[model samples]
Target: MDEIIDFESLKLHTAAGYIRASNRCFTCKAKRQHCDYKYPVCSNCAKNNTDCMAWAKGSKSPIPRSIACYLEKRVAQLELEAHRLRTELNPEHLDDKENIAANLSSKPFSGVCNSEKDDIGDESFGFLYFRSSNLPAPFDCTLHSSDRGNIRTFMARNPMVDIYSIPSKIADIILQNYLDIHLPQYPIVSSEYVRELKSSVFEKRNTCGPYEKAVMGIILAMSTATLSYKGEKGALASSGALFSYFLSQILQVEWSDKLKKLQILLLVAHYAFSNPYAADSCYAMKEALRISVEMGLHKELDFDHISPLIMQTRRRLFMVCMNMARHVFSVNKRMFPIPSELISFQLPEAVDDHYITDSGIDLSGPPTKAAAIHFYRFRLYETEIYDVLWGHKSIKCGLKEWVQKMSNNLDSWLSEANHFSTINQLKYRAICHASGHVRLYSRSPRKQWRNREDALLLMESVIKCLDEYLVNASTGWLAYLMAGVFHVEELTVCLLDIMWNESNWIFDHYSQAYISTQVIQCIGLLQQFSLRWPDIEKSKMVSYLSNLHLKITSQLEHGFVIDPHIISQLNFLIFPQVSTGYGLDSLPEDTVDLDHNFIQMQQWNDNFTSSLSIL
Candidate 1:
């Protein structure tokens, strides 16, 4: 600069020039290409848009150093920092940083992760370790090693050791009770076979295998339970436990005869209908359908070569299974497991137990046989009605026409049923009428009528059916069980809906005293049932009925009239309210007459009125 040298004209030439060495410029050296040593720039660097820095000889080089040394230094510094963090976080592992990193990566994460500062302790170190590591942590297990071992051991133990063997006399008593009470409705096992089993000696009485024994055990337990065995509490608990254990055994065993397997399943389903806790009937019916298919029970058999009793038994079993399956599906609103097209068997023969001899079933048995046949027909019609109502199948007509047709069918079924014995006919007819009322009640949400006459009629019919059932409940344990367990809840629900919900227009036509009296009578009937079967207290229905009874009694005693607002509040406490089409404005004027005998409440009313007189 002092000499005023022309820096623009200055050329830094290498010793190997005029044919310049490629190493004269940085770009030329990196590319290993020839460079034209032009003033202030080289041709290759200029063409490639690269910085041209010439290397100085015997002086410090003008090029910068590589970043590899700086990167190594920074990595050393990070390692030292990580060691310090590990020592501060986990002082126990300060001797081995590598092991600390491995343990941190392997530890399971137990809390949420965030970037915010945490309390300075082991927890903070855990956060730091998680942030530093890129590995996924495992979840904390709930079961301890010893607990898992215990479960394995428990499952591996022999289940047969838990079998509860009842004395032959007690078993016979229970079986006899079942035969007298439940066999008429569920007639899968032959009466003759049961008698044979009962009369045979203890050592030689092993007519059935483990599955059949288990089935017999469950039936006996159910029968004893329904009868409300007043024996020692230990005996009752043992019987209940025995039944559960036997059912578990039955579930474990592989059945060989499909008919017997289906019989067990159907019996279980029937038990479920009467008992509160036996809600697995649907699952059992599903399995029964699967087994039925495997055994080809849906196909019509060649009866020419088969024994008539066997053929009849097969048909009856199939029909009962179908009916039960239909009932389960209808209650749960599930699709039927088997398609209708697959079923080809006819209805069972109209033969009585007396005619079902060792030889064959007498086709021309007693008139009761006709009654049984009519009963089966009613059940079949019930299944069809359920299908139509639930939309499982399509109907050609509208809802009104379909309901009318079904109603006509029910009437025809009742007329045919009347030709049978009086007791059986009345019972079956009551069941049919009750079913019709239930259907109408179920459909009331969709179908609207200005008049409350239909609602009144339905209530009367349901009450009449209840009265009939209650009157008969004393005759057999089946009636008692059905009334206390099933009908009580149904009638109570219907009565409450009729009394409380003004939408039904029941209170519009009747006075508050009349409706209160009706409710009191219904409650009295429930009280009578509860008194008859003290064991009904175990049922969920009993709890609901108890609460409902207390509420109604308190209200009627306090002279509270049934109002819409009060009922709406009470509805939430009693049961879930469903939306119906009838409203206050839609109610018609009172035009109906109350049937005094509908509820059989004459004696109940007299007693209540006399009590009030005394008070």
Candidate 2:
């Protein structure tokens, strides 16, 4: 070897038959901390349990101490990221505020809109994470770890958690919260089982069977997610983690039947929702979809031996999975989801689980009590406008004909849902828009210009519905519903895009009065979203909308010349990183290669299901 080069810019000095290297290690140098630089490791790195700099470079890595330090450092980094995440997610952070984000005072365009300069800022968040200071706090993330190594080393320390118990009182709260909060998102489980679980927990002195305990653990994880969101995650900060561990343990049981195993997978997916970044639930979601297809829930008459009650439950589960699967198949991701036509199961009854029977159900005058089963029923009725307009192997007809057909169906839905509450009306309308927004966004540049008017209406409907829905909504309730949709940001991008260039089209059909009102409403809604979701700040959504607000107020009103740079920034779509890096991150376009692949997969699935029907 030519003078063995290693050790972070090592300097060897030979004076009177002695060689000396810098005492500081690479990590210490980067962090501006002192390093002892011991052979194969540093004393400070060993004490702190961080990866030694010498080991960072794999070539002739540091000794065993370096390996131990590296693993420890990773764990520390994870814990630090988790603990600090919740505090940073506080809706009322110091920097973000009310009054249409006045705190976001960094301007993107300096020369333009000097009259309305005060309102805008360089608060560009790429898509999800914002460029902000990484604040530290207590560990408020899901999956509570108790032991610095105590409760943390659970699987290695304790092989099984068959008898994990909390006070019956707390268990009761968790069950209720699960019913109220978690069920709305995933109404797969039966309410009767939960009732029985409570009775067993209380009467048997909190000693429950493995299955009941598993249910309790998963529910506890979801309920405490709310607590963490509210910043009330005191000692139970890691309760979610502990309970998740329990659920995972339950999953490994040899006796877990097929249905029970599938349920556990869904429950795991449900718990994964607490993370709020990336599609953490995607793998479990896909697994659940696979199992549902294997069980033949996609076929209406395949399971003749199964009781109607069991069949209905399976139908509900499979239909819900299909709904999740459709959304999960995004740009660049691939999956073979069950097609809508192949899915011919009866819509599961909306009645409570207890009220449902093996033979039949009574629908006495009006059928008021709506349960999770109603979600599938509702979707089946409307048939998802997006699916009709541009679904897998969509109807090969004139686009106008199908568009009119879907529009007529929407009219029918409005007529039927006339009895809906004021808030429910707003909620449903917003949802309908969410379903159709992709279609509303024009893919071709020509169609983009052609569809500007309809797209504007879509934006208006989304914001208007959201505005009314937020009238008196609490944070917990908001989290329950809003967790699923990102309509606000999507609308912001569309409106900002329209404002950037389509002024001619806008003013042609609509008046100055209309344009001004829409911009103001968009700004207001974006501000609300920024306050509600921390990701809004990081993604730089409000920044783009604020620019729109400025363009309208200053350039449109005061006759200031609009700058090309502001338009460029809005379309640039590249936001800053926390320190000094930037990258191209964006929402998926209307169509992708995967979408066509999905169509091909749909054909295969249709053939597969047709063959199964013959069997």
- Could you estimate the TM-score for every candidate? 0.52, 0.56
Question: Which tens-of-lDDT digit does each residue in 2-30 have in candidate 2?
Answer: 22333332322122111223334766766
- Candidate 2 clashes: the total is 12
For each candidate, what is the lDDT?
A: 0.47, 0.44
lDDT of each residue in 18-56, candidate 1, tens digit only: 112233665565567776765335777677776566543
Candidate 2 deviant stretches above 4 angstroms = 1-185, 205-211, 220-256, 268-279, 302-304, 327-336, 355-374, 377-384, 387-397, 414-446, 451-456, 469-476, 480-485, 505-615
Root-mean-square deviation (CA) per prediction: 31.3, 17.9
TM-score of 2: 0.56
Instruction: State how far residue 412 of model 1 sits from its true place (Å).
Output: 4.4
Candidate 1 residue 509 C-alpha distance from true site, Å: 4.0
